[model samples]
Target: MSDPTDAADLTIEQLAAEVGMTVRNIRAHQSRGLLDPPEVRGRTGYYGRAHVDRLRLIRDMQADGLNLAAIQKLVGSGGEEFVGFRRALATPFETGGAQIVAGAEVRRLLGVEDIDEATITRAGRLGLFRPLGEDRYEVTSPRLLTAAAEVGAIGLRPEVGLDVLEKLDRHAQAIAKIFVELFLAEIWKPFQRAGMPPEDWPRVRDALERLRPLAGEALLGMFEPAMTVAVEKAAERVVERIARDAEKGR
Candidate 1:
């Protein structure tokens, strides 16, 4: 295999071709300050593996629903500290908590003769199963799948479970937005205003990495009590309806 470091020799045109991007797009990124300027040798600029990697990283983040401004914050001045921060963030939050299972097997587990396309689409939206091919899927969370299977076994339609998942997804999105705004206001903006001193970049990265688990813990801590209150209120409503029905019968 060719040495990956040899990418440093590529010209702008070659680098753009190698990364499956248009030269115009590469120039656009440079103009937007999303990409660092290439190395200069007298008259010509040469791109490197770092540039290629950064381009790919930007594309991946775009696919993950990040806007260019969010991507800029994530790429973060192209320092080594930023690279480490990106790597840490790239690590799957869910890790080894899921598995790939055949679509037929998933249907069987759910006690369905054949799952409908709408159900599959809903499952995908819920991060339960991502389609791998015609009949294969990556189960994103086994625990979630188990809960769904239990609901199915208890005679609940998949639609009912999917409805609950839709509500959870909205709530999760709102919570994420709140936390990101907090981080931007309290942490990132202050650092930016101070010119993001190089010595402090590592600390900033560390703060972000530390926030991941803490954020997860905080969300769960808040969710449990909220869930308890919701369930209690629902149960109370059920009891009130039953009492009213008994009075009517009398």
Candidate 2:
């Protein structure tokens, strides 16, 4: 069926013509309780924007491979909650433009003299690069690329940088699962168990919208102190080793 017609009321036959449906089909929908009863003025029941909208929704549900019986059940059971859930799920987590760099530039950034086929394949597997052919790649996460470059500047080899990334990626995935499970258990399950109240939909969606940045900030906040403690411990070991080497030399 076509989109709901301009905010004007129409007769059943007029609505059928407007929405590309037969008059018989319109009556059948009304019989199935799929369409709302029209406003009756005397003997002739007039259809309105609401009727047009409901008809359009039925058409869409049918197009999505749902049978009439299923559509009836779904529409009878609050469909507004489904729409709210979809909107909440569609909330974006991250936003950034991808950067394309030549293979030579990539090598330079990683402080490598050359990039072998193996290195390219490994980077692709790690989701760091998408080969664009002709020796160019799309950097999936520019922030990660920048971090690799900084580490490379401090004399870490490209392979070593990739190794660190691979290990960190495993930890990152686990961290993501933790947050996702937390959301499902603490927020989503309660909402679902509550029968997904219409009025509470906004609160659920707002919680989803707030989750992403909160997760990011929490990770960074924890990582900072952890990194500092790790560095201090590593430096102590290095100093002890240097002192032992000096004693041996004497």
Candidate 3:
């Protein structure tokens, strides 16, 4: 119904049909304490917008792999707070957005006439790009493509950048797992074991939201010093080899 006033006029059968749910399912949800009982008038129980909203929320939770028992617990604890947690979890962790590029532009950037099938396939596997079936592609990270292009400008093949990216992705996944596991173990488990109190939901949701940027900042902070040390050692080895070659020639 367009108005909340009209929504209260809906019978249980009307509510089920409006929400695309079976009446039996609605009754089952009621029996499981997932749905609130409707207002009774004379011989009829009239459902309202709140019931419709709850059913929709339950449907969405089920779609996200939460069972009825979990949904009931979450709803009984406080549906709104759990919803906020879900919304926070669904938010993207990555900062940048993707862009679409023509195949010719991509080739020009990579310094290739025609990208080989294997390289394209490898790029797809790395989530670098998705083919749009008409000489176009959706690049997940334009910055990464630009970096590869810069590598090509220095006379290195794009595959070199992709190789480094593949390795980086592997390490990044491991690092991500560490951060997520840390949050679940240290933050979430304690809250969960405490019966997921209503008041703590906001704190838990806040922690998850705050973790998105913290994880990135922490990774970058750690990586900078490690990268500095690695570069220094690599440069030392290169200089040593060059001097040894010069001495041998003398």
Candidate 4:
């Protein structure tokens, strides 16, 4: 089987070559109705450029943990149009009850200042992030920079570390925004006063004090998987787009 010489007119041999299959194997697929016959260009059974594209898609689906039979059902059975819809049906883990993790605690754990406290302190003053306590500062706000600084490679300087944190600050904000909204919505319901005197607000407050942590517990179940899958799917889509671009230039 020859590789695709041009995108517009493809041969069975070319399709097999692009996808690393033999002509006999490709013919078998055609007999099984897994692939439609390409428009005849002459005496040859020509496959459209679309055939190559579909094969590539099936390869990717397999990598995503789908079996060959499932991939056939999806694309061969003309369910390609529903690919995105099927993806949307996936169960994303719910992420909830995320207590505002103090960035300072993360920094302390990552040892962001071990390389250069003086510089780190200076960066902090430059709005790196302040601690929530009387004398403490969190490695908050610019999360990206904090991460870089903490993971500073063996020779990475404090300045470079701060730069990483600055980058994170940008990306993390969008993620945090969604998380914050969900958190407050799921965990912060106000209690209705139940036949209590207007002056006795403390009773309601006390009830809420207990309710807060209890409510927080319920959120962990959702947030844990939600965030993980979102990040993964985002990365996968980015790479997939890049690959598509590369294929176009081929």
- Best model per TM-score: 3
Reference-based lDDT, each prediction: 0.79, 0.81, 0.87, 0.56
RMSD of each: 7.0, 4.4, 2.6, 25.1
Q: Which regions of candidate 1 are displaced past 4 Å? A: 1-78, 95-98
What TM-score would each prediction reach against the true structure? 0.64, 0.73, 0.86, 0.33
Model 4, stretches more than 4 Å misplaced? 1-8, 76-250
- Candidates sorted on TM-score, descending: 3, 2, 1, 4
Q: Candidate 3: which stretches are off by over 4 Å? A: 5-7, 236-250
Window of ten residues with lowest summed lDDT in model 3: 1-10
What is candidate 2's CA lDDT for residue 147? 86
lDDT of 1 by residue, 1-250 (tens): 2223634677888887777789998999899998889889889998887888888777777766768887787677544555565577677666447788888879866667787788888889888788888788889888778877887889988778778778888988898888778878888889889877667778777777777787799999988999999999999999999999999999
User: What order do you get sorting by lDDT, best first?
Assistant: 3, 2, 1, 4
Worst 10 residues of 1 by lDDT: 1-10
lDDT of 2 by residue, 1-250 (tens): 4344444468888899877789998999999999888888888878878787678777766666668897787676545444555556765564556789998988888888888889888887876777899988999877788888998999888899899989988999999999999989999899879866667777777788788889999999999999999999999999999999999999
Question: Which of the two, 1 or 4, has more TM-score?
Answer: 1
